[model samples]
Target: MWIRALQAVLDRGIRQGRLHVRFPDGRMGSYGPGAGTGPEAQLMITDPALPRRILLNPQMALGEGYMDGGLSFPSDDDLRGFLQIAARSAQSGRLPLPMRLAHGLRVRTKGLMQWNTLHLARRRVQHHYDIPDAFYALFMEEDLQYTCAYFRDDAMTLEAAQAAKMAHIAAKLCLRPGLRVLDIGCGWGGLALYLARAHGVHVTGITLSQVQLEAARSRAAAMGLSDRVAFRLQDYRHVPDRFDRVVSVGMMEHVGVPQYQAYFDKIHGVLAEDGVGLIHFIGRHTPPRVLSPWFQKYIFPGGYAPAFSEVIPRVERAGLVVADLEVWRGHYERTLRHWQQRFRANEPRVRDMFDDRFVRMWWYYLIAAEVSFTDMGMVLFQMQIARRSDAVPRVREYLYPAPGDDQRPSDTA
Candidate 1:
């Protein structure tokens, strides 16, 4: 009975591509058009009860089943191909009745689910970022920039692109010597150290994760910038100093919907009257919606990538002006693609670190995130904000000078 139910769900969810399924009882079934049509994928079910679980909660069940060795593809390459087809189908398909109801419930109750109180926020940060730092070093670039890289040129390597990302944000901040800067959600002190070394600024970076705090401080000391840069294991809300510049990269998603006002207020409070800041985050072009059940449960608990509409109002209410907003389409997709390749290349190392289950989970996470940026409405938003309109340059040209224009915007203008 459960097998029949799952087949019906798949028939509706995958009309554009073929999903060939081999059930636990050796019964074969296929959904969508014949093999000659669009993209095709095949999977085998190893557990008899998996069908009922998937029927109840397709997203969560599928991730868990894959991790637990209950669901698998014919080959490693087939896994990515299957995910692509599934993502495309989900973009244009409807969930089953039970799943739809559950999705709606999550959307309606998202505020409660993502409250993210101070203590709760710390716990959630440790849940993901506290994973052994060595494990992350295997896949990430030398700088350990876990956020999206700026691909200025299509041919740039991951390391070059990450450097470009820092330079891009630094340009927006309009740095000068002896300026005081604050780095919120500073990951590994990369950006803070960059600001100090490149711009000759004094930087204070804050994070909730102890591992990140230690790694960031050690990097600062090694770079001989400890005097110019500082790392703290503190929340943004508790900050009490003013800064000439502020920047947060890939950090706002964890600031829950309920805390949006307070988050902005904290930024507003700490920013000088003439301060300029930039926030880089993953945001959706679509209307605000609940986070994916699988992602929230297994990856980023209490996290939500918000819509621009959900953020702009809070910025306005905080008395902050949006100096500029840039949408980066296809950049994160490429970044995730690189990370996925690196992860696959180091699959043996990862498996040795944990087990086969951890390998499957990470693989699913990387592929799912890549597909989200590709097929879904996900994109990166680089918002330049200020306490006053005159804090930044009146023209956007300052952000993008000619190739050989090496001087600062103020110096050139």
Candidate 2:
């Protein structure tokens, strides 16, 4: 019964790519279109119980099966290639009636899943970000910008693109000498130090992760900007001072549906009358839905990539004007591809640090994120907001000046 149920899922879910499967009973099966120019992968199942597990919860079981060595790819097509096919197929196919009901139920109960109390928030941040700095250095650039890097062009290196990202945000913030800025959810103080050094502004960065707070403080001290920049182990709700500019990158996803109002309210309260703010976050184009069970259980505990419909109303309630919004469609895909390549290249080092299971988990996490952007209607939103209508320039000429007219740092500061 389980075999037939699993086969039914595979047959319906994989219409575009060809998937060759070897069952535990020594039976060979094939799924997807017989004739197609698409990703072709071979899945070998070693554990007999995996089929029942997959049928019970396909999204969670497949990833767990791969990590536990119960399932593996026999062909050169690795997990990334297979996930690309899976993501595309899921995007094109309609969800079954049961799955649709489950989705609706999840949407209603999303707040419960993402309670994000102050204590729980800290614990959750530590779960994902408290890993050793050396582990991140394996795949990240010199500055350790863990968020999405901007891909200006196809040829831009990760380092260059990260610098460009800071420059872009700096321009949107309307920076000037002596302006006070707040960096909420600052990963490692890269952007804070950049703003202080390049734009001559004072920055106060707040975060919940102890590992990140220490790393950020160390980086600021090393750069001789400790006086200009400070890193605090505090949540956004506790921040006291107002700022001329406020920027949060890749942080809003963790703010959760329940905390959207409080999150924006904190921003609005901390932002001065003439302040300009920018929030860069991953958001979906579709309506609000529950996150994957695998993702919630493994990668990020309290994270939710909100839909714009769920986000905009909160901003309005906070009395902040959405001055400008830009959708970054393929930028994250390129960024993840770079990280994936670098990670696989350093697989030996990663294994030395952890183990094969850890490596596979991280690989799956990165690839699943990449394809989420490519096929699942996920996008990066760079939203420039303000308390007043005229806080920024009337036109967006400041964001993208005429080539050399822009004085913002395009390279590492």
Candidate 3:
């Protein structure tokens, strides 16, 4: 009975990709079109409870099972391929009625997972970003940019792409010499340093992660830009100054939906009357009213990727005029692909840092994130806002620096 019921769930959830499942009792099953014919995923169910767990809730159980050794794939590469296919098929799919109600109950009881209180917010940021810098360096650029990078040129290397991302945001800000800029949720101060050194602005960066704050401060001191750039261990809500520019990259996801208006209101209050601000975040193509259970439990404690529909109204209410909006599609897929490659190459070090289970979980997180960007209608949105009507130029050409107007780091190692 479990086999037939589980088979039905698999067929509905993975409609197009082929997943060949070998049951614990030596029974075999194939699901989806072209099943067992050049299948992308082959699963070995070692525990009898795996199917029941999946039936109760498949979206997250699969990852949990993999982490706990209840499920196995032939290889890590195949595992990623399988997850990509599964996530793609599950994008427009639905879980069983019982499963939906169970998940809903779990979400309601765990409301603490999505609230970013001042004290708790620091802990939450540390939960994800407090890892040693070396771990991130394994997959990220030398700058240690821990956010989505803009890859304007497909052939560009990750380092160059990251540098270009800084330049892109800098140009969009319409910066000038001696202007003051505020960086909310600044990870490692790469963007802040770039703005200060390249654009001649005094950059003040704030973050809740102590590890990130130290690294950023050290980097600024080493680069002799400490005089122009500074990093503080503080929350955005506590900031008590105004600036000519405000920029936040990959930070709003942690703010939660309830704080949307407060976030915009604070940004509006902080900006000078003629200040220009830009916000870059992960947005959904279709609004999922609820956050994912697995993501809330395992990856981001309070992260909720909001849709523009949920974001635009708050900006209007805060009296911030939308200057421009850019939707970045498929670029993050390529970025995650690069990160996955680097992470794969550094497995020996990762294994040394933790165990096989931890390594597997990390790989699954990276793979699932890549799948989200590629197939789940997930994209990056950069919204430029201003206080005064004429704060920014009317034309968009100012955002594109001339051939030699800006300098980027070398792509080659």
Candidate 4:
């Protein structure tokens, strides 16, 4: 029955022109006969142990299997994409009783504080982003923006979409040429440098990762933006300087529900009276006491996405007016798919740095995120906010620039 089910999946891929199978060992067999050629061409998994290892002990076994010559792929990255697509489809079907029971167990035991707080958060961040910078460099475009790209139209590429996201956020903030802008949890300094170099805005970017901080600072220096854009190795809670504008992209997931109000208050305290702030974050459909056990254990620790029900009240208590709230649920699905493709395309390099299980874990993470957005309709929100008493119009709408137009010059502070 399992063979039949697996074959059905392979057949779908074959019919779609997404897969082709061949045997390189010259062994005649009834199953999947004449799939492909060459030592690396065959889809050679006859033993049940390999598949069982992948399924039962997924966190560690997959990586060990890959390293110990248990599996081979023409492209590891491509394999990641293929498995992601397949797993998502498979997950859509009704899960068996055992699987449901297992899920329930996970939910019941979720969110116990385990590792020392600092070490736990650090490990979680490292597991996902600590892949060698070069590995990320292969997939991310020149700017290395590691967040959701905002697509202006269906035709825009991921890199172009990302650039658009940066431009969009910058424009909404109305950054001035000499105004100080703070980027909380700046990833790779893409947006910070964009504001500093392109718009002549002085920017300060804060991050917890020492590696990220160094890379961002170096990039700023290389672009001769050292004087205008600065990268700091500090936590957002510790940042004391006031700025004309503040922007945080894809970072709120790290701030759990208990800390949401404190996070907002910090932003409120750090903003100049006339300052505006933009928060771009992944949002959840329902409120959960904590994140999923599987995600918390294997993926992001101390990470929880809150719904608008939780966010709106917190923001109101912080004395901020919501200028705008835009949700892009579909774009994130497309974005995750793009990342999966790039990760698959560059698997050889990835394998060199991390073990097979690590690869599969990431594969699952990316694909599952894609599936969540598609199946559950998860949302990505960009909120524009300002001090509640500010005289700015409550319903102001600004036009985003067309792709080919010259980037608007920054306002003079």
Q: Estimate each model's TM-score.
A: 0.96, 0.95, 0.92, 0.74
> CA lDDT of 295 in candidate 1?
91
lDDT score of model 3?
0.83
Residue pair clashes in candidate 2: none
Lowest lDDT block of 10, candidate 2: 404-413
Give the local distance difference test score of model 2.
0.87
Predictions in order: lDDT: 0.89, 0.87, 0.83, 0.68
Per candidate, the number of residue pairs that clash is 0, 0, 0, 7
Name the regions of candidate 4 deviating beyond 4 angstroms: 1-120, 286-290, 389-393, 401-413
Q: Write the per-residue lDDT of candidate 1 for residues 239-352, one digit (tens) a residue.
A: 999999999999999999899999999999999999999999999998887777889989999999999999999999999999999999989989998998899899999999
Question: What lDDT is reached at residue 201 by model 1?
Answer: 91
Tens digit of per-residue lDDT, candidate 3, span 107-218: 5654456666888788888888999888888888899987888888789898888887887888778888888999999999999998888878899999999999999999
Please provide, for model 2 over 164-227, each residue's C-alpha lDDT reduced to its tens digit, 9 standing for 90 to 100. 9998998888888889999999998899999999988999999998998999999988889999
* TM-score, ranked from best to worst: 1, 2, 3, 4
Q: Candidates 1 and 4: which is better by lDDT?
A: 1
**Reference-based lDDT, residue 309, model 4:** 90
Candidate 2 RMSD to the real structure: 2.2
- Sort every candidate by lDDT, greatest first: 1, 2, 3, 4
Cα lDDT, model 4, residue 186 = 88
